[model samples]
Target: MSHTTGADAKGHYFVPAASNYSTTLSIGIFLMALGLILKVNAMPEGAWAMPLGAAMIVYVLFGWFGEIIHENLNGSYTQWEDRSYRTGMVWFIFSEVMFFACFFGVLYYARRIALPELASYEEALNPYMGFTAAWPSSGPMGDPFTPMGPWGIPAINTLLLLTSGATLTWAHWGLIKGNRSHLIWGLALTVLLGAIFLGFQAYEYAHAYSELGLTLGAGIYGATFFILTGFHGMHVTLGTIMLIVILGRCMKGHFSEHNHFAFEAVAWYWHFVDVVWLILFVFVYWL
Candidate 1:
């Protein structure tokens, strides 16, 4: 517990002491997912699960990260450990890329192949009665609904995200240049921009459901629209929280020019979010 280095006297690789963080994290994720499923099915039991799980996750993250921060400040980590962290983050981002790719694939298949194939069938042969294969269509039995247009909030949000990316890059530059004020200001602006983007998205969702008659049940278009955008919004929320934490650290003089992998990791995730949003805007909104 009092060791000054991540390794022991024998110079073995560092292995952290076992903890319940992973177990609790798993439970939290499970409960949250279960709660979503239950609520979507209109079940009343497990109504409290999602919020409780979210609270648990927040608690775990704070406690876990606090311990790690302490360890880092104590000079416990070595170059090997830093390299491992970077490698792990890279793989994690790759997994996320694949996750989104699957959803995008589904959207592509539905739009390009599946819908047109359905359209090719004769009326008598069509199972969907009056189904017309069209982009932004609700299936045959789907209710009448206006599709969302991209020029309004979506366009604005895109600009906000792009600006946030630039601001974050400025913050990184400030960190490297040892300009504390610049770093703090850049991070602050980036976080503000991310918050504004989320706010606009929320308003857009409300408008979609209320004015445009768009919802998950609005069939393929609505489902795909929400699925893609909703997940991206969630990522933005997480990224904003991470930025806020980084801002707090910056104010406290936590990172040096050469030793800020945590900041770099968050920056990587933020940039990934920005790229994903650009693709989403093009394929889901513009197209």
Candidate 2:
């Protein structure tokens, strides 16, 4: 339970005593992944494993993060540790950028390369000679379905997210100026906007499935549309949860103008989510 002993005169970085948190978390992750694979394959034993794994992961994370927060509040972290955290967050966001980049790559290949190539060879294939390679195409065997337009729920959600980004920045300004009320109110508004965005997205998905016949099974266009938007919605959910946590901390006066890296880190993540959504709006929905 001992945290890093404050800064050493020898100038060595602080290394805390070992704990079993990582090992336990790894076991939980393994169980969760195995359960998912099994359940997808219709194995009965997976029913219990998935929830059990999820529970373990949640419990361990609460305990681990609680301990770190305590250590941070107790002044265990130094300039060196702060720098390391900044670098780690930078890399984490970079990895996320790459993750989405790969998905965008998939979308590009499907539309610009694969579909066009398929069109060129359609006559040669004979069976697919009737197929028309086009943007928002249902495959040759796919059912007729209306593609989603960009002007309705998607446009509203775009506005909501852009507004949330501005509100989050306002909260940062409040934090920097030591205005507790301003910070808390800004964060509260940001969380609300985020929740509203998600709700609208959920409704959009339901409409797609029920009315538009646009679904994962609807063909390649439907699959890519849902995949990109769905993942972005998940990220928004996570960002909203983080915003709520930061709001609680702000209420407790856990941060000062100078010591607010937790706030900054969450801000960085939220901004990344906003940027990604803009790209998605353009490529996946607008165009």
Candidate 3:
């Protein structure tokens, strides 16, 4: 005799369907809208407004991730879905790499070609007298741009973020080993380090603006410095929030060795941010 499993009255699987894809797409659209709105605003406080909107995006991501974890724990995902996720992550990282490459290219072109031509113009050339061209300098021409000192808080922040990267790797290793307590502790330490890095960055920005006269509108140097480092700071904020959500899920026992894609993705993002900051530190601040 052959046996058949009973389905629901509607002829569907007994389990409730997971809405992971719909939720992810909806949250992504909402975040994009918020970011665009903040970017187009002309208010005097628009700078702060952008960061506030970014925080809202992070809030949406946390909720959306919760749904994903719920679905995963409920056995809603299949092997094919897991493969799709990995492919999606690869493309996402590729896009981020391109994004940073654009900024770095602009920096290179400005310093190596555009600035020199502008400085040599007859009307502008005499402004700095006989000053020689050098990267990271002030006074509108070939003069060495006087950046705020590099060895103080900026250096300290470098150490903090680098250490956070190490701690996050430890957390990943703990997760792989199935050591729940160690994983939680490692994640907690990474978050704390990230917060400290942000705090020190705030202090350094204040000093740059108040004492060193390094405003975003100062010149090409200041503009590029702020744009590069500022965007990286925003990423750090997002990464920290991602870690907090992962920690919450860990506490709830949401992940397993074979199905921890969400945790691994965030860890990858955090490490990417860490590496970018290292380049920013050397090029924007120290050089």
Candidate 4:
């Protein structure tokens, strides 16, 4: 009897079609080139240039993920392949951790050392100057660089993302218990909560730019603030896409209790996003 199942051939590990990987790589290179050109020179208004570049990158991801799903459904992966996947996911998460660490290090340096130096130098440059070095706050002695306020949408967004993390955990439990209905509902709620979080964040950004005068160019503080949060927003976008695809697969009965490495990988990624947000909430918002 043949051990092969789904779309897999006997004794063959399921792999994506060559064209899928080739096309994805080609699109990636093209997007990089286009982005470089856009960064270097002025482009036309509503130009097809930037949008086309983004579209190509999205196209590559969609096709690449589709191929992976096809392979998973075909039963081409064995135990060894599953182990390889887990290792790959661990490494990917590690790389993301390092990326965030670098940004946080910059924040620490600016807050602990550079800000004081700038303020002291301002005082020395003119002895009569009343400049004082302090962390930004919304009080009488608050630094000018302080955000207008922090009690509104940013706080709400923090709550939304934290709740979504809990909801996603519930969904993962449903998957483990083989409760497809519970799993679907949990995932739906998580995705909706995530979208709401992002929406609120957009509102907060608009308010900051318009009212608080906080922007990427405000200073080192503004630059670090945007870089950390911006990268996190990008991760949330990716995680939401992953959840949507997983939901689609669940509807099609593509995952079984014993074979769902793809789902596991997505779950890992979602959890990482949740953790990143927790750190951001503490350092970026509360601090």
lDDT for model 1, please: 0.90
Task: Report the C-alpha lDDT of model 4 over 205-264, residue by residue, as the tens digit.
Answer: 887788777777566657777898889998998899889888888878877777877778
lDDT of 3 by residue, 1-287 (tens): 32111222433322334546555555556656665676677544555555655565566666666665666776666665577788998899788878887888888888888767656767554665654446665536322334866798889988998999898889888889998988899999999999999888888788878877788766777878788878888999989998998998899897877779989988989999888988878877777
Off by over 4 Å in 3: 1-63, 121-132, 138-145
lDDT of each: 0.90, 0.89, 0.76, 0.74
As for lDDT, the candidate ahead, 1 or 3, is 1
Clash pairs (backbone) in predicted model 3: 136-145, 137-144, 137-145, 138-144, 138-145
lDDT of 2 by residue, 1-287 (tens): 53355565555556666778898899999999999999999998789889988998998988888887887888777888889999999999999999899899989998898877777774666567766678888776677789999898999999999999999999999999999888999999999999999999999999999999998887788888888998999999999999999999999889999999999999999999999999999998878
Query: Best-fitting candidate, measured by lDDT?
Result: 1
lDDT of 4: 0.74
Among these predicted structures, which one has the highest TM-score? 2
- Could you tally the backbone clashes for each prediction? 0, 0, 5, 1
Q: All candidates' TM-scores?
A: 0.92, 0.95, 0.78, 0.84
Positional deviation of residue 250's Cα in model 3 after best superposition, in angstroms = 0.8
Q: Output the TM-score of candidate 4.
A: 0.84
Candidate 2 stretches greater than 4 Å from native: 1-11, 122-124
Q: What is the C-alpha RMSD of each candidate to the true structure, in Å?
A: 2.2, 1.7, 5.9, 4.3
